[model samples]
Target: MSILDYRRQSVRTAAPRRLYQAALAALALAVFVLGTAASVDGCTPARDPRFVGTATCMTCHKGITASDLRDHFAGPHAAIDCETCHGPGLEHVRAGGRNGILIDNPGDDPFGATPDLCARCHADAVDGHAMTTHFTKGAASCNDCHNVHKPGGFVFASDPDRFLDNAGYVQLCGECHAQQTGEFLRSGHATKDAVTCGGCHDLHVPATFTAPPENNQLCQQCHASFFLGLDSPEAVDFHTGAFHPVDPAGSGASRCVTCHLPPQRRTNQDRGPHDHSLLTLRPAETNALIAQGMTPPPNSCAGILGCHDASVPGSGAPFNLDHPSDNTVLQRFFDQIGGIPEKVQ
Candidate 1:
């Protein structure tokens, strides 16, 4: 062949070889990319060997150790590691998960390591929260009501209703208030609403039971118009004649439940809880027996027990010997003032 023909033939062969090489390179690149993706998918960097999950994380949570794990952790996510709540602890567990790599990056793939991430499990709680006056404002979170590793236990674990029965209900309420539960038990409205710790309070949203406005709002929930005329100028004067003290802020202060029906004289057999009844005696006839001397000291015709101190005269009308007479006058006064009487003859 000629020299030019030879050159052309070499060029043609070299062109095909170059194209084949280029194709092979492309295939190799694709394989590399696919392999890289698969590796990333299968091995999520293999969480650190030292990583202790939530169970281990709970070891130090002394405060929540006594809480009900069954109520709070009874779900699939319960098995999730504590690092999931705090963050991936590869670096943390290696260095000890305290103040280590706080996988708090919002852009992370799971995007659930943020403080707000707990909302996923607490969505129902968030929706039913009392109001904007409480945790709904975002000042609190699942951590406020629950410990990630340890919860507050069943708020009403002892109650049959799973809400709060009488005894268990009072105990939970007594946690924050050492005196109020006892007073509430003695109040007239106790049996009417079958009120208990869970009656007006939501343990999960403690503010619903604690906040002043919230407390009054809860009272109004069952009271309806109990305080309707309370703001009027004559309300104080009128209530004074009908109720023991009439002044909400006075030494003889009475709540709405106090005047309508007062606590019974006898202590409860179970928890010394008061029995609310309008009559001084539970049956009214008991009051007649006391007055007739059929019953002894501490028992009276008015059904009042130990309330009469004839020597003290008017030290306290309700507890004084003349209480029955005073109560009668007051009842009449209330009737004249358009106030409803207790209905007991």
Candidate 2:
């Protein structure tokens, strides 16, 4: 046979093979695209039908009626069905009890006291809390801190931003951290009913119960009162260009914690045992000071509980209350944060 004729025959045979390879590649690509789409949209595969609704369960367990279901139906999780967290109820309702809530065994429930059930929906939010002392070591449950059935902190309050008490988050949180809450209650902020757990805390994103130690992101959200400069409420602002030259973003005194919530000695493995008094060690109550007409203390709040002493300096600080910031040395001693480090001793 001629070489040209042989080449023509080979080309004709390769065409179908190439087409077969192309078809296989196309099929594989289609499978991959669909698989990814399913995963991204969170589509679950078919499973045995088990849910029978909250009404069915109430029928058998007459005592556990709609009254028991009222609180759960009213909260933010209102849309979520009882079966979502409590497994399914067809068997339990038929059999009559807690058997349906279990995963493997007949009566071993995963949600009685642990954060496991809540984690199913709140994995990201509970990530930090899950690793914290309260959840892990303390063996505390989600229900202990949050009344999952009835969340009324915002709904029941007059200010909508307050309560942190009286069926509010503050009261709920205080239930566990009683001493800390009590200390917080005595603080000027509490006295004014200005803040709550949700105010400084993003419960969904805490590093721990008290993981975040008063950073700028959390502080700026509410206390922008000083962001306006001398025209601010106290006729003194905390931002730059005020006499205090504070780095609002700074971590220590340059920020708010230095003097206001000065660090307290750690107790019970607490990292940031904040004073919660929220006091400036000897705040310049100008009007009250004028009435008293006496020279201010050398360091308004100098000591371990405050910031820098009246004497030494660092980061252009060591602000002295004795030599308070007037127009003269304003920028240098600006926002004078007093007190030496609590560890100074």
Candidate 3:
């Protein structure tokens, strides 16, 4: 018989005694490791070294730049001690990091610490960061987004929005969200002053983050007479007897995005978030009308949403939605590109 046929015929049904001994040894090792882990609650056992201070750790880690040390000691996080993050580095210092606890960011913790470790200190900071797609699904760590242990440790923001990471926020967040950064930069928000990535986004929040006014309140935060658009006396204008109320709460919770900013094609991988353009075009309604060879109305968006008695075909462009000058600008731009400027893959 061939070698294969001979091997099949000569099968040994029972595993050897030595294999059993090896399995027992492995089980014992696992239990011992688990027991050691359980002794210290979750982190490493206290058998390591107790944390001394920055002075002790710095004595060995001489490579830490002077500016970094200054920032650490005199900066925003000066109140917090170093050992809480890097763990007790006493063993790390004595062992010279060859076989000891190596101090690194959360993303590269040698012992594989979870985001909850961060949540310990920042208990009230980022409400939903741990549950975000960036954390749970994408396996991203907090340090990946927020620069740690450095000068101006947090974001680089502008006036009014001191919490903004205006300086490094764009480039740091753009590392993964390139397509979003491009669209955002081209947006009027970027063209306008006093707005940045953190101006609208909570980095601690999930992939799609919206600030206070945009999330819970109306678009009037920017579009109202009080903010920037002097033309939006919407409170008085829409309250007229035969008014077309755009208020979501007043008119059956109809969102601004219901007509203006619906979902668009993917710009970044298969990410399913809608377009950040925030334009007033309903491509679905327009495409349907054009398929029937109907002309797009230049002004007067009254009939499509049934605010008017007469049937105006196509997505009737909303009337008095913005200033006449703003309408001109939007139309000119829409007709030029048909959509956003550059959508990266």
Candidate 4:
């Protein structure tokens, strides 16, 4: 019983010890793997000495006047650390928060560095905005219209109340487009509050009167009844008839804006922007403007390019009111065609 019993007892104890060693090895391996991952993913100073952490930046950046750092904590970017968008702040902090130090101010560099910084998180928005007139014309930037700290800063057409009065988004755009804004303010769009600038104008998309189908779609959003074949027979005839021949959904040349937003005839008529007043420019009105000796002459109907130009078989030439007879004929043409739909009149 002595040797045999001793051997069995040793085997049992050795087996338990071996199992404990293997468990300890696995635990050590897991700890090592996690620690390496943390080192790689975590924002530690050793990873990049310039990243001093949000806490470090907050130590001196609490004031609203000097820095929005205080307000930042209460904003949409609350969860996002300062350095994420601002870049590393160690050099800025060391420089005593100097104005032009290492810290990034997206507002200051809106067109350039701002787009790049925001693209890291908002690639789609940046890409979409790139296609707009704002970007192409260098007329505005992201921060120009957006309040970086507030979610309400971003204007959307669906959120009417916010877009209408939240921050006077139209006024902001008006700063650049003074003429259009002035006309728009007095026009039905602004006076009635039926729609905001964002209602028809997509701030981030290619837009113009040339793309009739695309531009007409914006008008159809509100004027859908005019396109849905729900209008009176006269109204339907007014749009699709031989006289007007406008198909909003079709690949046609005529557009809603083409009639409503006639070009303000300047010396060089082609260069002028279409009227934003949204007033229908019938031949009768054009006659009145021409009779009033309106300089450059308002070319609403007879002068819109690709409309009733010389391209038409019977249409002789574009009438710029150079001759009195053309004006007479234009008026008669409208009278014979039964004029615009009563709804628009």
Instruction: Please give the CA lDDT of all the candidate structures.
Output: 0.41, 0.47, 0.45, 0.59
Q: Stretches of candidate 1 above 4 Å error?
A: 1-80, 97-115, 130-132, 136-145, 151-171, 187-194, 202-330, 333-345
Give Cα distance to truth, residue 245, candidate 4, Å: 3.1
lDDT of candidate 1 at residue 295, scale 0 to 100: 35
How does candidate 3 score on lDDT? 0.45
Better of 1 and 3 by TM-score: 3
Candidate closest to the true structure, highest lDDT: 4
Worst 10 residues of 2 by lDDT: 40-49
By TM-score, the better pick of 2 and 3 is 3
Better of 2 and 3 by lDDT: 2
Candidate 4, overall lDDT?
A: 0.59
Rank by TM-score, descending? 4, 3, 2, 1
Q: Model 1 — TM-score against the truth?
A: 0.35
TM-score of each: 0.35, 0.53, 0.55, 0.68
Clashing pairs in 2: 164-170, 164-171, 243-334, 244-334, 244-335, 302-339, 303-339, 307-338, 307-339, 308-338
Best candidate (score: TM-score): 4
lDDT per residue, candidate 2, 1-345, as tens digits? 899999999999978865654454344344434443444222322122454554443343333321354555556676665556666544454332432233233124343444566677777757867655665565555655555555542323223232354336555676667766777788766787767655665554445423334444345444444332223322223332243444444554344555455444412212556556666544444224434876533222342332444343442345553454531243334354332222122
lDDT of 4 by residue, 1-345 (tens): 799999999998988865654454344344434444456456444256556566656555556314545655544566776677777765665555545467777767646457777788888878878887778888677877766565444422222224445137465777778887777777787888766666666665665322233336656655557544424435545663466555545543445666566777533444567687876566666557657786434555644453544433354657645445566677666555434464455
Residue-wise C-alpha lDDT for candidate 3, range 281-340, written one tens digit per residue: 533344444467765332212212322212323424343222343344434433432221
